[model samples]
Target: MNFPLHRSSAPLAHLTPALWRRANRHLLAKAIAEFSHELLLAPQAVSRGEGWALYRLETPQSEYRFPARRLALDHWLIDAARIERRVGDAPAEPDALAFIVECRDLLGLSQDVLPVYLDEISSTLYGAAFKLQRERLPAPALALADYQALESGMTEGHPVFVANNGRIGFSDRDYAAWAPECGKATPIIWLAATKRLAEFSHVDGLDHARLMREELGEGTVARFEAVLAAQGLDPADYWFLPVHPWQWHHRLAMAFAADLAEARLVFLGQSEDLYAPQQSVRTLYNLSRPDRRYVKTALSILNMGFMRGLSPYYMSGTPAINQWLHALIHNDATLCACGFDILREEAAIGYRQPYYEAALAGNGPHKKQLAALWRESPASRLGPGERLMTMAALLHIDADGLALLPSLIYASGLSTEAWLRRYLEAYLRPLLHCFYQYDLVFMPHGENLILILDRHMPARVLMKDIAEEIGLVDRANAPPGAMERIYTHVPDELRTLWLLTDVFDCFFRFLAAILHEQGHFPETLFWAEVAGCVQRYQADTPHLADKFARYDLFAPTFTRSCLNRLQLANNRQMVNLADPSQGLQFHGTLENPIARFRPGAA
Candidate 1:
């Protein structure tokens, strides 16, 4: 009952200058490479005598150069070690924070947004320094580790986004307590929100009482009830909502003090379960009971451009969206054959401060602060000999330059190409089918997908973080009722982006590079295999031929939707959730890598 208000800070003594420099250098290399890819930097190629053309990005104060090889879609392959930063005739180390400040005008960073943006980059560097403190395991060793280990070990934030880990609201202490890389279990505080002010939704067959009994056990429930009764409150009149410990300490206790004092919002103390924060810091996995559902809470921290908060308005339709997706996936033979599964968000509960909601017109900062959702745990559905790991791990490379994909390939006892095929089969086919069959698309980034491994080979894909990120670009195909919220009338050109930008360009681009760099799969072959998978899927489904033609998966080129550009232009709320297409930053076009391999292509 007497947990301390503040936990110890994240260990920072390990952030030696050497580690800090390495972190900054890595961040700078990515910034230069991706910024150039987005045309924010015009890097001229310089002759390097050995037939290698190292490129240079020159600013007024400094010049930076690195060995890079251009790939499809202007993807930058920069050599970090070869990168050189200079300041007025003296060689200088690359500083991530300083680099941003130096290029503020170039990045089009506004006066108001620049400082807060810098804070995010600084926090990101701080996180990288802490990650460097841990023992660097080889790719083979890491591939053998369990799901959570692989998830936490991912060092690169987003391969393209420069300030990927900007958890601005987190104090150094908050970083240690809540950040995923800390690898520590955090206890969550439970709040009983009065029914009148809070909205709770769940699918059929699951209720609040059953969830409380399963999650807290009867003994803890009785204790919580006794506490409520002692405060002259009836437990039946309130719905239990999990509060992020950070929100409680930083925002809730003081901001909503009147509610707590009036006994409308009652603190039921810390739950018995120990949870590990996932890649998206706000969500936590039940380490105590792996089978229990994962809890997603709103921290309201500015991370990777948006306030990482669960919107209360968005919470209302989450369960309905998940149910729609689940039913569709189960009914489709193509998706079932591809072994695609979604971790359905079964229930969501949001607490609204009436005053805040009224004052801010429901878009207030605090409106999103106290909400939580229960998403079905992928672990609960794993069959025998199956293990789960975040899809991000496929791109993970250890300090020794060994990549996890090859190690997984080695462990699968299959040849490199065979392993690649298996992975694409498990992952890519379902995405294509979803687009062609249902006009449905998910935010299929690495962290959003969990790879179910059978003997170290990707067997199935478990999709998560539903309701919020999902979009239906084709409004005509929108199903009736609650599912209608996902509908958006995106232009026909942008519809293909669901696959072209998100899956092929965003995810597979890095994966293909890693596999090739590790000498396992060649870039051409990799894209060819992806092309083969698409063709095979098309052949199998003759009924969907017209749909396939409409949503062409093998177009010659697609819009180069720039991720960092969105952040560079507006670090706070980069993409408007209400209209994602309006927030898109398209920079010319990227030649589709698989264009030549398309069916009937010359």
Candidate 2:
């Protein structure tokens, strides 16, 4: 196969030897740390010191040695500068690909999946190099940066996932033009789908026409309609939908060729409103109009273990769920007091291809194609002195080796514990109430939440990417059909894992490590503040005391629900979104960091 990804000279400019080497070093460090944390690779300590050690990982073919600080929650903080790779005593370069290949058997990378996983690793490195190529904003500068800047400045995509930025399907050109790190103002493609084949769902207050008027002003609407009229087609016969330009050219045009040819789907060209991709590649933020709804399209890229696609069948009840949750959460005094809220996915549209619909059994990339959703922006929700930053930025370490959380703390003029407490109140405490009181849980990972900051402290949080990500543990709490898909049948034992695994193990694990390493903050203090937040929430809500004991946040240890293991086991379709509880690959248990802070603990 003659490859064309690098045919354009400038597109692959970031892939210089120097940048590639640096990217390799960084990627390999992460892979080693994460792989070791998951217990996939056991590293032997060569020498040990207080709070740190020199560890060596040996494969049959290669031996790698690095000085690493073993932090709380079994996080290995590797010193990348000192990382050494060797082949029979001769010093070899530390390459992520080479490391993966060496540990292939240990990772259980099957014959079919090995190459694909390596391709993903290469893509991840490609993205890392691209980020390095740009003039990096250090954490201090980034602390004061705007919303989209913070989103773009996030060098590390997902903290835990080794192949975090593996946007595998995106070509070199696509990375330059459309990747989140590129910070390009991407104009989305507008396609009109025949009403017969398209599905549009919106909140009760806004109709399709009004939503159009609000989204695209009356002038743009008229212009689009005029284009439809010029072709002797009535604008009323079709529903105008926005699309990712890549999808329009590569997937939709080819996959739904018959529909396009038969006039069922008409390409109306690009829209005027420019958007910038958020941390989640599929979701785009309105650049021209900050208050405008975010347009998320069905992207067929294989990244972070899933072919990122939006199902039309799921779209039908999206608005209802959001509306329901908005009412339910806002009405709840505890959640509202915590300054917690969600950005509703107010409107959604999905173009159903008849042939694919008939042939496909369930949700996949095929049936999920040609769909879009408009999410409520946090811009309008921000108070006078408040601004927005992705919660992911908290764990962000810029190219200059500065963590944004410390910079944010310094900028906020608050003590580390005070800042930590405020954050927990805005984020973790609200999540605890949701789980303990309402039996609700979201995929409360970093990217899923947008922190509304007052100066540099997170005064409140505006949670986005809802509807699809959220789950109701108690199916009874949902309004019958509203949460049919959102209902998670996690056993009573594993329900605490939502807080323990997702929050503590996945998110706070990295956050704690970053705080401890970047700033002089102690790990025990971080957990103490977290514990205090939970204690206060519990104290305030005495009625939920029984519920709290049942799903104990202060449990000694919780099941280690591993992210890398899930992706390593199956890069594609890591977990079925519909029944996510079924696919959890639990190797062992993690000592809950907050267990010491439990009431009456020694």
Candidate 3:
């Protein structure tokens, strides 16, 4: 009963016991630290004698004992070497999958989500092992590496999410070929959708024909048309789009049989250009031509708490949202002062399957099976002597345990304080101005923002994922249907959380930990520098004094939004994207680290 299973047999050769142990230890460290940050676990410090403190965390089914140091904002820094695992006090293998099962009750995971969640956890562990097996690149080498290399070489997934690397729908073969960490170049499958069923939109002056010509050269476009013409299909009636090769093989062929049978969706062969997957697995950069726009596709894989599907309905408004925000940024003096810009989503096309659109619910993932958007490349926007890297690279620690940020800091030749100050001005100041003056905010997470580097220090900030992530709190000031897709009624009190919880707590908390633990700077000095940035911005924008007081950036405490808690409650769809603030899972408050340095505070 032999079967053709060779493709799956050797893909995971790196998952040895030793590498598995290292990956397990790292995953456990993240789970313990992030779960504690979410307040799901209360670790008690116990003296192990000789002036060392070992912390004990207990759930209903298991106990974990480890030595850890506490940092600011209730962060737990677990020493991976000293971690111990047990079931009811008996020693056991350190299995992160088991840990999640043991704490399932405490984490509020439902019975239905437990098994699928475990599958995700195991895949994440495999990803960690694959990363650990790679050749160790020194911090300086990684800091100076080319942009795509650094993007694929990032070791840490999301800093806080335990199941951050879960690409649930990917098989072993798909993981090898498509996962960003695999560092493989994939040639995308091209498909033609009937114009009657698909909606295509682009920014003014950048129409569909021009984009096609620019992306697919005239020769390739003519060849594609010939392929369609041989099937008695007119290319003029069909719109061509790029599809993730995996999705085309695994989903569209099987699920949309009617469309194919009726010749509504015609197949075109692969494009000549190869694409390198970016940090966001769904977006790919054209490796063959660096100046070409990035292609972001609709993938049904579940990752980081939601099915990574681009909604067909939402796609209609994407170009409008990008254009509106682009114009707003160009007109605003405050945003320009910080050298902030966005990589605009210039063109988008979404295929609305008439069958699935009628059968599925409005929010179902099936309705978004085939779609792609073209985003302006940051590479095309680079100025002289400027290069780009995802801000997430700052937290990357090689397998040898050296941090990347210090190398970048040293290469800049600026004192640590001066470099951090410059970084904050580029990265954080625009966030402050957008929130206070315009009542607008971006999901300014590390992956969503690119750090434009000059001589190894951050010189400008380029925000991406624009159409989906930008939110406006003041709907009254918004023009009719400008950003209607993201416009929702967020309460006045919760408006600033787009900055505090998303920016300060989620992103900067780990960054501060990395810098302080690596001896680059003290945590105190880090927060004080942030305080100085806030104070200076407030002083310069005295006209917005009332708005500052209303939002109160210097407030002593802010809501501690629990990210893992939301995922635990419902891993499939943690929060409805339409109205995100309504689904927040709040667990008390975190005293703002910069609160003490507020004006007039001793």
- Pick the lDDT winner: 2
lDDT of 3 by residue, 256-338 (tens): 88998998888898988888778899998988888899999988899888988887677778888888888989999988888
Q: How well does each candidate superpose onto the true structure, as a TM-score?
A: 0.96, 0.97, 0.96
Assess candidate 2 and give its TM-score to the true structure: 0.97
**Candidate number with the higher lDDT (1 or 3):** 3
- lDDT for position 538 in model 3: 92
**RMSD of model 1, in Å?**
2.5
Clashes of 3: 0
| Higher-scoring candidate on lDDT, 1 or 2 | 2
Worst 10 residues of 1 by lDDT: 1-10
Which of the two candidates, 2 or 3, achieves a greater TM-score against the reference? 2
Kindly list the per-residue Cα lDDT of model 1 for residues 177-197, writing each as its tens digit.
888877778689998999998
RMSD list, candidates in order: 2.5, 3.3, 3.5
Off by over 4 Å in 2: 1-9
lDDT per residue, candidate 2, 1-602, as tens digits?
Answer: 11112123587788899899999999989999999888999999989899789998999799999999987788899988789989997999888898899899999888888888999999999989988888768888998998888888889888889988888888888887778888778679988999998989988898889998998989889988998899899999999999998888879889888998998998887878888888889998888888899999999989989998888888878888898899988899988898899999999998889998898887778898889999998899888898989999889988878888888999899999988988999999899889888899998889999999997888899888788898988878767864577888889998888888888888998899888888899888888988999898889889988898898989888888888988988998899898889988888888888989998778
Q: State each model's CA lDDT, in order.
A: 0.83, 0.87, 0.85
Residue 17 lDDT, candidate 3, scale 0-100: 97
> Which 10 consecutive positions of candidate 2 have the poorest summed lDDT?
1-10
